[model samples]
Target: MHRPAVHRRDPRLEIITEAVERLIPRATPAHLTVTVTETLPGTANPDGTPHKHTWTGKPEGLAVKVFTALFGRPRTEEQRSPLAQAEDAKRARDLVGELDALLAGGVALETAPWYPCRPGDLVHVHHRAVGDVPLTPAFGETYIVGDAGDGLMSMQLLAHTLPDTVEHAADMVGCFAAEAADCPVYEVWFEAGAHLLTVVRDGRPVHVGGAR
Candidate 1:
């Protein structure tokens, strides 16, 4: 069973989330279902370490149709607006190129302040890409696509969360890892046109779906 989530606050988290919501136009009640939740600390991987505080949630619109069909829920998928589609694609490519540049630049964990919700700290940002879907189904769901590092993953590696900015996102760069920089695989998704979602670690400034 999934354990109950925790609650905490970070200024950066709020900023990023607001940015995503404002920046991405498709994440409306008419288009998606977005849920932001905080995760409690727990056991680490086999390396015997403590877990980190985490946050995760789905975007507002992508799965409305499929999810509703699968579970008899309401139909909330927006009309598949052309503007939304175009915007999603452009953002996905932009994010991919941006992350690639960060790696190429040799940037590291020193970019942002360490997340306050966990034991360890920011390490690096690992990135993955998924193609031709409603959104990048990285980590098993849709999200604004981006890479993450181990400092963010120590709690629950590969967990997904929405975006919130607390004045720390612009500075975040490169993938982080506590054990192996490329150990556990991460997934990211991009819709055909106007949306890109990435599920990165909490307190690390990596948020899924588009942040404004």
Candidate 2:
């Protein structure tokens, strides 16, 4: 059985969340965009507010000033308008569709945060939480696509297979292991695409349905 998850707050991320919570005027769009700085870039008043808080030489908006007080000053930051970000995501989804065949060929894990699910190999997974309460499906399943040995596996996601994502999704919170199998070797669907997800049973590959 999977153990319940534990969560802790990150002080740095909290700086932004708290500023938004305390200072954001109610009715602010859920998608409001603002540029902020960790650096106040000016003298501080006795109470600590910067004497000359500004952005790129111009005075900062209220949101920027609030964040500036929390973070020293950012070296670089960018906030695209929500609509623009949405458009980018839409285009990206289309692009992923176009490259389905290529993506199906293989997968790799990001170096620093590689998640391991080898029986008895323990690892910590970062995921969303509400005041120490982890979100359900906190660790979404990984549907492993193939083996890369030395504990690295090319995985995907679904309940019974490897796990839930073809790749790491922004909100994936859990890892999955099969109950029992004889080389699953099956087709699996990912966001707007499909690919083969194969599993080895007792050191052997199970090829099926035109898949190797």
Candidate 3:
């Protein structure tokens, strides 16, 4: 007997790249990739599209482990047991004043000096899109730092910033912008409950997100 084929949903790597770009226009290719675990399986065809596998892994300990790693927290057995069974029924209709404050900020996972990602650099990003707001790609701006007598030092303007100053033309001192302007965005397709983002740079995945 012959088996039938199954279709899989497209991945979400492209969306994250676009979101980074929207925030920092000069952002260059960083990396992007996705990996699915026991929940689903697939094989690639000659043309390269993945064909979905119908069999699914049962969710229990393995599923809990995957979720904990992705969200930076391990699920407590007690929290997963009777608490889930109770369903928080008492708080069903209490939706007012739940949040204390909604502060706007960016989270940085890496710290390094300025680096060059020239004009022709291509990058992939993965991010979540909600409602109608477009996601921003990850990136940084390029600029000159100082002259080393023979050549000028290349620099990348970091992506995080707070505020700034204003002055007259006579006191026009050029300052590096604390944030990066995004550009050339793309979307990444991901499955529900997947925790890690794999970034394929130059063919092989170099960095993994949702870990740090």
Candidate 4:
């Protein structure tokens, strides 16, 4: 069969690379076969296009272990008790509320330094956390924002402060923001659950009220 041309660099490939590196950091590819999922623009007529497939990369072992360390392992009915199940339901809602509260008054994403994402229609974001906001963790730490429900938001930190001479912090004075002008930015808290809510549709960053 005739297969159409594929992009030179698949972002899923990059994600797999990043995930592996984030953990192993240095490892020779020998027998490592990873499985990744990709959404492609498929044949369309009147219905919708559905061309979703998986890229091979184990998405298991280390990455899964690390991810689980941050976000607990998903439980099945056989494994989880009824009380645990009830708690799990409430936990999902709690996490959403906590995430919302954290990013309640956040500014645009591009305004931040070293965001993992960039602007465009095909914005690439492999969220570190779950729920509405998939904020990245700090130092692979487990953080608790609200009352800290089972520490669901733990391991990954969602809030960060942009560096500044007049606005940047001491630690962020000369780093992180260097590439802020070049990459697409996802949503970032104005300053850790303090600023206003603003999602960036356009590449332009909105830097109006609030400060980190």
Q: Give the higher-lDDT candidate: 2 or 3.
A: 2
Per-residue lDDT for 1-212 in model 4, tens only? 11112221111222332356434433333344555667767554356766677755443344445544655542222222123333555678776544543332222232232232322212111112324442322121111122214322211233443313322234432221212232212222222210222222243322211111
Residue 48 Cα positional deviation in candidate 4, in Å, after optimal superposition: 60
lDDT of 1 by residue, 125-210 (tens): 22333466513323222222223454433322343332233233223222322233232222111111112322234433343222
State, as a TM-score between 0 and 1, how close model 1 is to the true structure.
0.20
Every model's TM-score: 0.20, 0.21, 0.19, 0.21
Q: Write the per-residue lDDT of candidate 3 for residues 83-163, one digit (tens) a residue.
A: 222233325532222121000000011110111222322223223332453223232222322222332232222222111
lDDT of 2 by residue, 1-212 (tens): 11112110112222233244334443222333454565556678899977654343211234345455876443232322223333555677865544542332222111111112233222211222224432233332334445545544443343432234424443343233333332221112222111122223333322111111
Model 4 residue 170 lDDT score: 41
Query: Model 1, residue 52: displacement in angstroms?
Result: 48
Report the Cα lDDT for residue 97, model 2: 42
lDDT of 1: 0.31
Tell me how candidate 4 scores on lDDT: 0.30
Model 4: runs farther than 4 Å from truth? 1-17, 21-59, 69-71, 75-184, 187-212
Error at 212, model 1, angstroms = 2.9
> Model 4: which ten-residue window has the lowest total lDDT?
1-10
Quote the lDDT for 89 in model 2.
56
Return the TM-score for candidate 2, rounded to 2 decimals: 0.21
Off by over 4 Å in 2: 1-36, 46-112, 120-212
